[model samples]
Target: MTGSRKSADALGEAETIALRVLGFIASTEDLFDVFVNASGVSADHVPTLAEDPEFLAAVLDFLLMDDRWVIDFAKAEGIAPEVVMQARAGLPGGDLPNWT
Candidate 1:
């Protein structure tokens, strides 16, 4: 699904996606734990990292690692399932699978 030009043109879709992803993590303990563990960001510093787009992309990337999480987040957030990939691509590295 195409995102609104207004949202995309404003602060950027990455920001919206990041915030929503963070919200998703906030609502789920296990997901938050996994993000904290995998991201290696101290629990106390998560708020700071949450302000970082790269880090937010990492959050989305983490979700991208699992189809279930992607689907779940989509359903829960009421966003298009395609938003995940768009958000993933909005990150620093885009959404290409790592072969290295």
Candidate 2:
């Protein structure tokens, strides 16, 4: 396979993980409200925002903020916890340096 194909596959996987995270957040009322508030995105706009790589990256970013959240989400999704960070790294703007 070519490099572009690999990149596309990685992006697709990352987007899938992000969508799962969004669903997980939506399933919990408090988390859903918190995500909406923190993202400054309305519930109605989520479907559209879900298509944006940057927005998807933000979803993973939010999920990564808490170790418990990552554990719960990974357990619920049957994915390893580290997969969340890998997915985040695959998304747009994820390659940027984090000076903090």
Indicate which candidate wins on lDDT. 2
Regions more than 4 Å wrong, model 1: 1-11, 95-100
Using TM-score as the measure, which candidate wins? 2
lDDT of 1: 0.80
| lDDT tens readout by residue for model 2, 3-41 | 999999999999999999999999976999999999899
Per-model TM values vs. the true structure? 0.80, 0.94
Whole-structure CA lDDT of model 2: 0.93
For each candidate, C-alpha RMSD in Å?
4.2, 1.0
lDDT of all predictions? 0.80, 0.93
Give a tens-digit lDDT track for model 1, residues 16-92.
88789888887886888888889888989988887877887888888888888888889998988788877777767
Colliding pairs, model 2: none
